[model samples]
Target: MSIQVAVNGYGTIGKRVADAVALQPDMELIGVGKTRPNHEAELAIENGYPLYAAIEDRIDLFDEAGLELAGTVEEMVEAADIVVDACPSGIGADNKSLYEAHDTPALYQGGEDADLVDVSFNARGNFDEATGADHVRVVSCNTTGLSRLLAPLQEEYGVEKARVTLVRRGGDPAQTGRGPINDILPNPVSLPSHHGPDVNTIFPDLAIDTLGLKVPATLMHTHSVNVTLESTPDADAVRELLDEQTRTFLIPEGAGIDGAGALKEFAMDRGRPRADIWENCIWSESVSVEGSDLYLFQAIHQESDVVPENVDAIRAVLGTADAAESIERTNGTMEIGF
Candidate 1:
């Protein structure tokens, strides 16, 4: 039997998650919940997804826009086996009771507080953490990327500490209201960014610090990472280890994929949906080690990397498959690798 999945929030992540869920043979995307009757709502309807009003009071707004509604979000949650809440930050917390009342499990995005869910999930780092849990939070894209790299290094080389500098895009392409459009701003303007603490939600004991800056570009977010390990491995050995990860895409220097623009172009040329690079794109030449420290530069497609993780989280919470099996099924079905 296919697991029935409903996505709440029809923004960037929610829309992508709905599409990814539809691709999974073991799951069915039953419906999507949207708070507004915007273009995304029209796209969902056009895609043949049943559209439910996330805010009951806003139903008339959708009607006013000439979009048909499936029902209220409560009705959708009642029918779904699981709900993926891609609502913006702070909103998911408000909708928790609706899912709880229906006894429907839910997976929330990283924007919500980690304490809002039972487990902070990263498919590779802690898939089992979400198994059978009623609620799970898929860590943010930045945290997801960091976890993907950290997990392997911690296992094979044993990390002593990690420091990361995140160069974040001001906003998603659709988010026109966001800024630093002309200038680079020190986001949070604080010592260590919240990202390091957010990572701790997945790896409680891991020592990591993060700094964040918002750049003018909306293309992609780039990360500069340095990890001090218990054992030093040469650059080639480090590359070999990261290359083994199914979700990590190593960008070879010889390929001339110099930056995010080329990487996005490469994804588009490969016919990737929305030019989405679901895998973490690490510069092959960036992998380096000195003594027991490892350093690398990687680009994260913030809008899309979490899409597959949400799919895997559904399977995890449902107990339908183990981590390896679920990840393999998701990767194969979604064509995740480069």
Candidate 2:
């Protein structure tokens, strides 16, 4: 059975999710819903996606802009087996009633409060947690990256404690409205930024603390991760374990990929659509183990890392496939590993 999927919000995350869903053999792209007749809306139509006006009042605006329409957001949601709410943070919460009214299952992004969803999902960490769930949040890019990394470690060696320092990008390349364009500022200046807590939504008992900062770069978010394991494994052993995971790309010394800029260039060099890097780019040279603790540096593509997780979450929520099969299918369809 091909699962019908509707993506509401045709922006950064939504656009990518729509394309990824279209790539899945077991899924059908029902359409996408947008608030206005922007370039993304035009792209949706050009790509042959049925474009639905997100707001009834905005239908005239789309007509005025000379863009074709597929009707209203309500029609799209009611027709789909599930809806992925890729709307801006907090906006998904406001639109929850629409999905609920249509009796459609919905997957929201990480910007939402934990209380808003039945479960917080990371395909590697807790794909089963989202199984049969009516509402699941795919988690933030940083949390998704952390979850993907820690899940393997915890499973292989048993994580005792984890600490991460996040150097986050201020905005995406197109997001000129965001600030700190010339400065690196402590984002919250508080102990344990929300990322650690967000991860707990997946691993309820894992001891992890996070610190965050905002940087001038927009290419990706970098993480300085320190994980204390119960068993002492050498750096090489850990590297082997990480490389075995499909969602992780360990940057080899020969790749000469020093940072997120080079990483994005490498994706473009490989002809990745939108230059999207869905895997966590872990610097192989940065992996080190001292005593029972492991340290590494990884860059998370904020715009794209969460894209595949959203696809896997679809099958998880619909109970269509197990984690391994779903991850492999999603990876194969999108070619996730480096």
Candidate 3:
């Protein structure tokens, strides 16, 4: 049976989720819910997705913008077998009850509080844990990158502890309304900047602490990560292990890669738009290891990194199929977490 999926808030993440859903053989893109008639609304309609207005008052805007309205958000929720709450952070929190009211399973983005879901998910790390979960939140882009990096170490070498300093993109460049543009802002000067606890939402027993700062970049967020494993592993060996993982790739030093733009350009140069989904762009030259302390820099594509996770989350909640099966179908065609 094809799972009927509805994406709410047709913005960056929502639009990507809708696109991913359309390509899935076992999933049907029922429609999308959005408040305004923006470019996303136009794109959704152009792609033949039925468009539903989230705000009742703006229902006429669809016609004004030359797009057809499928129905209201409530109607979309009632019809869909699964609802992806891709609304902005706080908005998803407010709409939790709506999904429950329709007796439909829901997938939430990382922005929501972890308490809202039965499980928090990172495709590589917590995918097994995501099985049978009713509501799941895909971890934030930063957390997702960190989890993918740590999972291999924890499984192979046994991590003792980890510390990460995040240099976050202020916000999407398009989201220019945000930030101290020319300044470096200490997001959370404290030792653990909600990220460690955010990670705990997925791995309750993980031993990790994180610090973060906001920078003036718009493309991607970078992490300066250090992990103290129970046993030492050579840097080259570590790189080899990481390269073996589908979601990671060691950025070659000779590539002249410096920032998110370089990584995106690298992917585009090879005809990839999302640039191999889980390949979160690890810097080859930046990898370092001293004794048990392993350090590296990884770029997290804030807009695109988490898209596949949403797709996997839908499959997890619906349980109509296994993740591996869904991933196999999406491979090469859709870029299954790189």
TM per prediction: 0.98, 0.99, 0.95
Q: 92-186 in candidate 1: lDDT tens per residue?
A: 99999989999999999999998898999999999998998998999999999999999999999999999999999998877898888789888
Residue 238, model 3, lDDT: 86
Candidate whose lDDT is highest: 2
- Better candidate by TM-score, 1 or 3: 1
Rank candidates, lDDT, best first: 2, 1, 3
Q: What's the lDDT for all of these models?
A: 0.94, 0.95, 0.82
Lowest lDDT sum, 10 consecutive residues, model 3, at 329-338
Reference-based lDDT, residue 89, model 2:
98
Off by over 4 Å in 2: none
Residue clash pairs of candidate 2: none
**In candidate 1, how many Å is residue 306 off?**
0.4
lDDT of 2 by residue, 43-104 (tens): 99999999999989989999999999989999999999999999999999999888889899
* Rank list by TM-score: 2, 1, 3
Using alpha carbons, what is the TM-score of model 2?
0.99
Q: For candidate 3, lDDT tens digit of each residue in 176-286?
A: 788867888888876779889987776677799898999888878889989988998888888888887777778887878888888777777777654434466788788
